[model samples]
Target: MLADYIHFMKDDFWFIVPALWFIGYACKRTPFIPDWLIVWILLCIGVLASCFFYGWSVRAIADGVIATGIAVFSHQIVKQTSARDQIE
Candidate 1:
């Protein structure tokens, strides 16, 4: 299971993950857009961008969603941990 995940990360999701992270982080800084809308827009961009590589297949879309989720999860982990540490 671990190997499979590593393979997926190396072959499919490496670039998309970081790119989406940066996009989301940048979007979060914009005050004009509501926070709720930022994530949805970022996910859509990730999915659409993946289509360029996978040519509109289900796999492409799935990979995009997974990558985006991973990026968001990682961001939240860092954010929450840092906040908790600061409180101490």
Candidate 2:
């Protein structure tokens, strides 16, 4: 899973993950947006941003999705770790 994401990801766009992470955090804190929609919102932004950088193409879209996945997956890992620590 990790390898696949890495293979599809573009090294030049390293900033995208962090950018999406912060954006995701912002969306998470906002009361109006439902939790379920955050991923979709991130996906749209990620894809568009990457497309802007690499030009519109299938590879760009894949890279964007991979970046977004990494961002979201890392966030969940941290949150889960904290929650587990608190529970134990």
Candidate 3:
């Protein structure tokens, strides 16, 4: 099952995930960009970055989507976990 998802990632392309995380952080700190728009911005940037690194292909696009999803989901998980602790 895990092997099926391997194509969604490439060793060199894994850098995109952390890069997106930092970019998302910068976007979060920006006063001009609305919160809702950050995700869309990240998505667009992710796809473009993926294409730039992997070349324009359907798999590149897929990897971008997955990478972005991973980055955002990871941020949320950390954020929520920390917040939950604070509530205790």
Candidate 4:
């Protein structure tokens, strides 16, 4: 059973690589947008990634990583924005 699942993932590894990379890039480019918007965008990405990769299943690890990435990305934006606001 586990081997079957592993095989499925191996076949889809190519798709997952690009998807994860794009998520990282989007997080990096969050400065041009609002914090709330970034949160929503990340949530959408998480949902889509879950649906695509897991179908009707739940993925704790993937979801956690996605949420953590969004939180870290948004934290940096908030820090930079606060600094800019203080300067102004």
Candidate 5:
């Protein structure tokens, strides 16, 4: 399962990953919805979008989740690091 995901990432999903990430990041700025809902909603959208390319399979959802996770994790890391730097 892991190998398959890695292969998919290397093949085509790499491009979509950043796009999904940015979508999640941008969602944080919206005022219409609660902050916590943004990521979850975007994640569902990402998975559904992936289905257009990879079909309704576990791999599609998994790839979507992995991409989302990467984006969210990177965002948090940057936020935390910047906050720490400002404090120091």
Candidate 6:
């Protein structure tokens, strides 16, 4: 089971590249938007594409949602850490 999961991840990881491309395009198309939420959206897109390629529809959707939430949480954490570091 673990080997199967490893193989799936290895094969479907390329989907993330296209997802990042989409995010870049979105940023290029709308230069005025400074919203960092786009990062979470992009990761969700990546997760969807990964799921479509891997044949795990339910897991992919749920993971994508979870990934988005994590992205947001991580983003804020990074921002806070950077601000704190800059003050020191």
**RMSD for each of the candidates:** 2.8, 1.8, 2.8, 9.4, 3.8, 6.4
Instruction: After superposing candidate 2 on the true structure, give the runs of residues whose Cα lies further than 4 Å from its correct spot.
Output: 1-4, 86-88
lDDT of 3 by residue, 1-88 (tens): 4345557687678788889999999999999999999999999999999998889999899889988988888888889978996877
Off by over 4 Å in 5: 1-10, 86-88
Cα lDDT tens digits for candidate 1, 17-59: 7888888878889888888887788789878878787789888
After superposition, the stretches of candidate 4 with alpha carbons farther than 4 Å from their true spots are 1-33, 60-88
lDDT of 6 by residue, 1-88 (tens): 2233333334445345545655646764796856665775676676776577666777666555444444445556667978996877
Task: Estimate candidate 4's RMSD in Å.
Answer: 9.4
The better candidate by TM-score, 4 or 5, is: 5
lDDT agreement with native, every candidate: 0.76, 0.91, 0.87, 0.53, 0.72, 0.57
Give me the candidate number with maximum lDDT: 2
Report model 4's TM-score to 2 decimal places.
Answer: 0.37
Q: What are the runs in model 3 whose C-alpha is more than 4 Å off? A: 1-7, 86-88
Winner on lDDT (1 vs 5): 1
lDDT of 2 by residue, 1-88 (tens): 5566776677899799999999999999999999999999999999999999999999899888888999899898889988996877
The list of candidate 1 runs beyond 4 A from truth reads: 1-12, 86-88
Per-residue lDDT of candidate 5, residues 4-88 (tens digit): 4455442677667678767766776777778889778768877777777899898788877776666666677778978996777
* Superposition-based RMSD of candidate 1 using all C-alpha atoms, in angstroms: 2.8
Q: Write the per-residue lDDT of candidate 4 for residues 11-88, one digit (tens) a residue.
A: 443344345446656766778776456555655665566566656455633553454454445556667978996876
- In model 6, which regions exceed 4 Å deviation? 1-40, 85-88
Q: Pick the candidate with the highest TM-score.
A: 2
User: TM-score for all predictions?
Assistant: 0.81, 0.89, 0.86, 0.37, 0.75, 0.46
